[model samples]
Target: MPTKQEILDLHFMDARYKLIDLAAFLDRVDRHSGEGDFRFDALKAALPLLLSEQQGRAKAVLDALSDPSIEPIEKATTQGASGAPRPAGVPL
Candidate 1:
């Protein structure tokens, strides 16, 4: 099993790859499509929001890992009264 830091590192690297892939994909689409294409416009508009969300998630994970008071992620899950598993720090 990977340690917490290792897991967080993998998450960060994966996020970076995803952002790069999105940019490359968009570039390819832009090159193939003509101006005023709805798909290009839509993708261009959404990229920033997607980047922001990924950044936010990365920051949150980093913060959780860095803060000593925060519980370890491995211990941050439990079965509720309904016998359903749920994550800690997240409310259903």
Candidate 2:
């Protein structure tokens, strides 16, 4: 495996850019006015994984945003997925 410094040297800038992008996206969302969004809730739910001292942070975060429902719906609600599942009991 590469040394910690080596890993940082190769990928830190890209990670920095992505972190900034995510921050900017959150900022933009906060500037808008509307009812709560479930997709945004998923994004918020996944943020803590970035700070976690655990392996598989990527998978954990992806799982956080994933649709946990096992059964398929009988009909289409919209044209396509909104990228993440809505939290249960929340209105759209």
RMSD of each: 14.5, 1.7
Every candidate's lDDT: 0.52, 0.86
Query: Where does candidate 1 clash, by residue pair?
Result: none
* Tens-digit lDDT string for candidate 1 (25-82): 8677667745644334444544445446454754444333332333435543445332
Q: Which regions of candidate 2 deviate over 4 angstroms?
A: 89-92
Candidate number achieving the greatest lDDT relative to the actual structure: 2
Report the Cα lDDT for residue 4, model 2. Answer: 98
Alpha-carbon error at 49 in model 1, in Å?
Answer: 2.1
How do the residues 1-92 of candidate 2 rate in per-residue lDDT, one tens digit apiece?
99999999999999999999999999998998996578888888889999999999999988888888898878765787777877678543
Clashes of each: 0, 0
Best by TM-score: 2
